[model samples]
Target: MSLPTLHDLHRPLGSTGLTVSPLGLGTVKLGRDQGVKYPNGFTIPDDQQALQLLAQARELGINLIDTAPAYGRSEERLGPLLRGQRHEWVIVSKVGEEFDNGQSRFDFSAAHTRLSVERSLKRLETDCIELVLVHSDGNDLHILEHEDVYATLERLKQEGKIRGFGFSGKTAAGGVKALEQGDCAMVTYNLNEQGERPVLDYAADHGKAILVKKALASGHVCLSPGVDPVRASFELLFAHPGVSSAIVGTINPVHLAHNVATVAQVLKQR
Candidate 1:
């Protein structure tokens, strides 16, 4: 039998009317190397290398590309690299957070939110982003309730600047609140951490989308001996019917292919 690719497992992104692959390609490593939590140090891939990696990902059936304004030059690089192939991928970006000089800052006021979305569109060279999440500063509930970010995202959706909007929240309550007013929530879920499982349950019950971040625990899952960490991670994620897709940030082509194959295997068994 032929090995399955992510293309074979494309599914609905909540009610946004977009179909996305089961594994999303995260571009953090493609841009920034500072303040990252990965286990080892690495150099950023040049444009040629980055393009080759993207081509490999596409050939392996990945169509969801996750980027963010806080991910260094990620959005800017993707603009030109992904030019002329805009329709081929589902792009997910974020607002409310900015990274500069190896530091991070956030702005969630209505004015900043609107400016962020417009800047993202310009950097991405696209008229509309498929999904935009508010990058939380670990103050999920506070940002959800007091900040104008979510409200502005809703306005952006109505203005046709974004297809869907949600929060990359740090708390279950915030995730639930986000879905109550938005289309999806990016939550942290993996073997080491299940604190956000409630968010997944909520999404399953409510027909909202849940995109998982740090599914491999930021590449820290391989510490256990004799355990297939990749397989283990995917099993834990796919077992939850609410998980729309897991964003895996890997720049190495071999690792990317392995992760996809493992995800394909785990989903097939499900």
Candidate 2:
């Protein structure tokens, strides 16, 4: 097959008033982490190769690219590619984790949040990003208690440093707290891992946007859920009233084309 288009993944992000594709590209492994491996065996692809894959994503009509400093060089490697195509897409990144001297870890204080955004802005080579998510891992609520992190992001919003803000955790309770208190505009992850029905309901009721991060179960559920597992995985998130889109990654043009095709079929059904 020639692969699908981005029709279904493209939709308004709740009351975001901005139309976003239901499926997006996540840029986690396009960096140094590629050097690491598992006993299961396999080698990570090269950066140049990853960049070419990103180029293909653009051709496929993928409008959103999600990444984080914790993801190693994903943001830095993205700088060159994104600089030329600034207006062609929505770029989102996280603030909780950063890399230093070839190491990656978390820092969610107010100062760290500001520093993270600044670094991301530079790495992304953009004046302002479409969205800046607080990458909480599974610790979303702890950020709320600190106050500085949320306040800083709020200030960034007012200053137009970011178009909007969101939270990325692997759980629901933390998202619920952030959604209720921090004016968090979006929450990531979906029913597969989090089964965040309550939080999604809140976001829908409140007009907040909810994004499905691991909606396809990290490709673990790629097969059992639909006719063609990959294609069906792309559509499953849209079936939920809460999910706005998902961030799928690949350093392969063929996979990018497949993503586009799957999303296109979803749009047709909708």
Candidate 3:
């Protein structure tokens, strides 16, 4: 079956005034291959292969692309690879977390946040990042209220370094709190995990954008015989009007095409 273009999935990302495809391509696999949570280990694709995968994603109508400093050299590689295609993508990157030496570290301070955004800008080779999310270290409420991260992001937003900002939070309460101070929240919602539904509910009522992370449970969602988990997951996710996009990471063009096709099928049936 022919897959739909991203135009078919174009929708507003809440009240941010940003339009995004229903599915976003995540770039973790393109940058980071070590110490990942995927069920199996795999080789990270070379730039040539990565470029092909990205081209396939764009061809499939995916406009939103998510990456972060923690995703190894993802931000750096994307900077060069997405040069001419910059305007065609709603690029999403993050602050607060860094991956080095096969380990992860967190730094949500205002100074670090500023530096991170600046670094992301240089690495992405873009004048402005469409969205910059606080890559939470699972301390959702504490970071939202007590930390200076959102304030820094707000300042950056005002300075036009970032077009939008939000939190990839751990808990529903944290997601809600992040929304209170930002434009969107990246929550995890899939067939195996629905605990973040309340956050989606709040986003719906408040007209805030929501970009779903781990939408496929990081490829851990299991299905019974005769069941397709991708179709099931999208059906549940898009059923909510608040879901702006679901970020799926894959280095395989076939899987990317299948996912886009599945999204089309689910939306069509609905």
lDDT of 2 at 130: 81
TM-score of each: 0.98, 0.86, 0.98
Cα distance off (Å), candidate 3, residue 219 = 1.2
Order of all candidates by lDDT, from best down to worst? 1, 3, 2
Query: Taking the tens digit of each residue's C-alpha lDDT, what string does model 1 give over 1-270?
Result: 764578788988888899999999999998899999999898999999999999999988999999999999999999999988899999999999999999999999999999999999999999999999999998998998898898899999999999999999888888988888899999999999999899999999999999999999999886478889999999999999999999999999889989999998898788
RMSD of each: 1.1, 3.1, 1.0
**Which is superior by TM-score, 2 or 3?**
3
- Comparison by lDDT, 2 against 3, better one: 3
Flag clash pairs in model 1.
none
Across 1-270, the per-residue lDDT of candidate 3 in tens digits comes to 666666676899888889999999999988898888998787889989988988888888888999999999999999999988899999999999999999999998999999999999999998899899999999898998888999999999999999999999889999998888789999999998889899999999999999998889998989998999888899999999889999999887888888998898888787
Clashing pairs in 3: 6-61
Q: Per-residue lDDT for 173-239 in model 2, tens only?
A: 8777777654343444433454566778787778777776655555555345446766666555666
Worst 10 residues of 1 by lDDT: 1-10
* lDDT values, one for every candidate: 0.93, 0.71, 0.91
